[model samples]
Target: MANSNPNTEALALGRGKRPKLDNETVCMRMSSEIRENLEQIAEQYGCVYGGKPWLAGLLRMIGSGELLVVPAPPAFNVKSAVKDRLKRKHSS
Candidate 1:
């Protein structure tokens, strides 16, 4: 038997239509910490259509000023970050 709901059926069949987007592809490099923070931000605020975070949508939101990208606070220290990572590594 098939799902009565088309959306559900499409999802079940792995046939969900990919949204059309611009042909241009953008890529950049960032530190692991920054990338992880970005992913966290996406998880928190980027799901407009699907339940999961959409990175492209998140970037759009940032570009549109719907989301604000702020620098870390004054007290944020690079040495402290390295130390924290080291602690986690040893703890594991």
Candidate 2:
């Protein structure tokens, strides 16, 4: 049965609309020491700045071309992920 209330209809339609993809996720394995160092840097920078320190730092590096993104192995088939990241960077 369809929802009779206008508010309910609107809410149901709103749920169908997905949010725009603005960021691409990258998953990598890192050592415990590296994770600890990153956390420390993130905390220190977060105190100095207002936003998320690690994310901010990563974005800054990517924007400045300081960070190099090597392609994932063929088995991973990560072309779409890379494309999305490029699109996101260009859009911003």
Q: Of the candidates shown, which would achieve the greatest lDDT relative to the real structure? A: 1
The alpha-carbon deviation from the true structure for residue 63 of candidate 2, after best TM-score superposition, in angstroms, is 4.1
Q: Name the lDDT value of residue 11 in candidate 2.
A: 64
- Positional deviation of 64 in candidate 2, in angstroms? 6.5
Write out the backbone clash pairs for model 2: none
In order, what is each prediction's RMSD in angstroms?
Answer: 6.8, 15.7
Error of 1 at 36 (Å): 2.2
Q: Which residues of candidate 2, in runs, are more than 4 Å off?
A: 1-21, 47-92
Error of 1 at 13 (Å): 22
Worst 10 residues of 2 by lDDT: 44-53
lDDT of 1 at 39: 64
- Stretches off by above 4 angstroms in model 1 are 1-19, 48-52, 78-92
**Model 2 C-alpha RMSD to native:** 15.7
